[model samples]
Target: MSYKWLKFFIMWLPVIVVGLWEYVRHVFLLPFISMELGNFLAPALVFLITLTLTRGLFAKLEQMQEALQRERLSKASFQQREQLARELHDGISQSLFLLSVKLDRLEHTELNDEARETTEQIRKTVKHVYEDVRQSIANLQSPAVVVDDSWLNAIHSAASDLLQNSGVHVQLDWQLPEGVLTNKQMVELQAIIREALMNVRKYAQATEVQVICHQLDDDGNFDCEIRDNGVGAESSEIEAKDRYGIRMMKDRAEQMDWSFYITSAKGEGTRIRIMSGGDKNE
Candidate 1:
């Protein structure tokens, strides 16, 4: 039998036994005692015991429900990480490899100054793509841990890493409430933030960027914003044709049932935000 059913049977057994004892005392034992107090005391004892057992059963059920939820979330996270790994390997990694080969061939040919500079740019772009591909693979392989630190730390770390490596400056002003996030949510949030930072590095070309993360008053609702001050929309339209980072970020947010918004104006900047109704207690 399932543990829930077994626990129910165990908890109910005491009530059943107590009820029988009370009935016997009132119907038979009370006559021997010849006291109305025995009848009252017997039923009172039964009631107390039954109440305790019922509370225990309810507590056990609550614990079981929490455990099941955590298990389901863990399984889902593992599956998603696996799928991301496969997609990165099959799609981005393969494309980067082909691009590298093309760049190598171009380098071997003789070219004018302009063509040579163009080849160099292509090589740099290919190198950046390769690095991103490697990082995505690494993130997929890394195990997620729940820590008692600020969520902003994770966001800052990702942003800093991207900026330091890609020569982009990210300005962040975020205030988060004192609450923990689940492991799955953290992983999802981390991936989403990383993707946004990558887009800034790859396409934004803005000198400065800003990030914000905060909780809303409603239960389970939270929001994050990432904005950059760079050569914006017009350049972005020309750049978006080859950029998959934004699309991947949106896809990851959608997978977690979150809302994503992005806006940009030419010569102005780009801004991206994600909103979700996700539990914040890890």
Candidate 2:
């Protein structure tokens, strides 16, 4: 039965039962039962009937409501993914395709040796970006289910991909529960880590990198860090060279209200940290 109808029945059942008991007592049982006994039995009988009728119904209704909520969340997630896919396909993907075509034309045109080499390098980078964009679109178009280890695997995979040929040693420490993070947290955290890893691969000149994420306490607060044992630069220099990537990461952190900061010195390695201040919902 629908919850509304069930609730209505439960609410009025006691009153109806009491009224019927009073009618039967006055009409037929007046000689058999006293007013005192009828009054006491009426409440007892009503309680038993209500308990019998509504025992498991409440639990069932709770389960049904929970299932409905999950379905709504799933639909919202799917819609967001669809919108993102459209944006990438219509905007970044098209732009990358045009850039690739221009690079191909430049490859065919006559050029000096140095210019040709530079063009080839730029072409390779653009090709990589285009491939990444295509892969993202494909993923967005596909059905996605976030399993327990999915986000963890994503972080590991990103690190492995970027540092595979760079000869950098990687250490990963993840201790937070799988379900502790919200979807926005997962996305923003992964993006920040990927950006930091890319910087390490391209400019850190580091031999070792460590990625760590764990709960701060029994509370829901969490801490995530990306540290590299590389030739770090001063704050000003880092801001000058890595402004775009760092700014993007900062913006993402701000969107989620997470704390994000970078610490580095000329000789010391660079460390990027993002902390959740016990707030998990977006």
Candidate 3:
């Protein structure tokens, strides 16, 4: 409101200057108002006009700057929420499913020393749940961590929860130099990796898994491959529930204009490849 008044006053500046000039010329006689003093006052009046005009302009610019900052903060908050949702789906959700499977086995399976073994399995599964909760709390405290070797630390952080909770083994190998992929790209890529690993833990009765990340120099593209030695499915046949994760991985990869593909066989293991444009400066 005060700034608006400032603008309103400035709007009449041209008329004010003319009125003041007429008053000075007529009311103050030639002898009283010296020519030298009049010349000095002219420049002073021009300076005051410039100052008033700039005041309103500066106020408008300040308001625009503040609004832009607010918009950036809101966008950042939204991105963080999306990332958190993916984490829960990939980490804690899988752990719960595993717990349910364990309980199902305990309820149905029969053995000589069933009670003791069943109790142990249930305890271990419950312990995994506790550990995942603690890890989730820690993640809430610290959103991300980086290793000395650039993205390596980020990849480790991404996989830590899944490895701790799931029975399957994961092995990571990468040859990515620093500044090959931007932080945002790295995060989305890591989320896709976690999703693939989660599916393996939940569905693939695998014993060992391998993750490889490499960049293709010819086209400045990154290639990530995840392979597991588990009961795989036909690439052509996908169940409705399993397809959601696949679609999500593809969607995230597409955010960076990357490519996502999957390969599997009934007896052979499953492999996922996510190729991204490897320009870190973006």
Candidate 4:
């Protein structure tokens, strides 16, 4: 029921109940009841009536509260996923485009005549991965403002989305002051970090991840690190099937003049680091 109607009914209920009770008492009970008894009995009837009506009103209020709470939670969850989708589009989607270009170059230029069939196979795989990412971005995006206006908040949203859904825990050490990285750098770095996290999810088999960003001018380096405590793999395993994600990250880092490194040992987890060997603030 609408609150307006319910409130109006409540406002008039006490008056109607009191009038009816008074009429009945005067016509039917006035003869048998003493004056003192009638006076005492009047309060008891009003109390009972008020209690019954207010009890229902309070119950309705509780129901409304619960529904409101549920809606807020549902909206919050959708917004979080929406934010991740945007991040994927901004970071991974662009990197995939780069990967396709590199694959095209390799298919046409780098392969020997004997390797044509194998190169064609890898080309088909790359095409499939590229299309899958595009489809995901389309299906995942919503018209909601999923991210705040800050780059760090974008990073936070990415981390939150991953942590909320997976068994991985994140520890963030943000040391770069706001506005230090150019917008291009921010986009590249965001995508790089995102790809690193996905690798951890798909292959790292880790329980914890730490993202560390700093401007260590000891040798004028801008560095970001993603570390995980998970089942690590040998370098050969890292180069095995579906290593395109890592290559995309590396290409993105190089595009921004940042050096990307992935170091791992069996049973020792993995560390992915990106460094710009120039001005730390730049």
**Per-prediction TM-score to the true structure, in the order listed:** 0.63, 0.63, 0.49, 0.49
Task: Give lDDT for model 1.
Answer: 0.74
lDDT (tens digit, per residue) of candidate 1 on 109-145:
9899999998999888889878878887976755443
Worst 10 residues of 1 by lDDT: 142-151
Tens digits of lDDT, candidate 3, 193-278: 76787678766788888999887875557788999998998765644553666787878987778877778888898988887754
Query: Of the candidates numbered 1 and 4, which has the greater TM-score value?
Result: 1
* lDDT of predicted model 3: 0.70
- Encode model 2's per-residue lDDT on 172-205: one tens digit a residue: 9888886677665776687788778877876789
lDDT of 4 at 161: 62
List model 4 lDDT by residue over 162-216, tens digit each.
6776778889998886546655576578778877877777678788999999986
In order, what is each prediction's RMSD in angstroms?
Answer: 7.0, 6.5, 11.2, 14.5
Q: Report the lDDT of model 3 for residue 110.
A: 69
What value does the lDDT take at residue 85 in candidate 4? 82
Query: Rank order by lDDT, top first?
Result: 2, 4, 1, 3
How many backbone collisions does model 1 have? Answer: 1
lDDT of 3 at 6: 63
Native-structure RMSD, model 4: 14.5
Clashing pairs in 2: none
Per-residue lDDT for 281 in model 2? 41
Kindly report which residue pairs in candidate 4 clash with one another: none
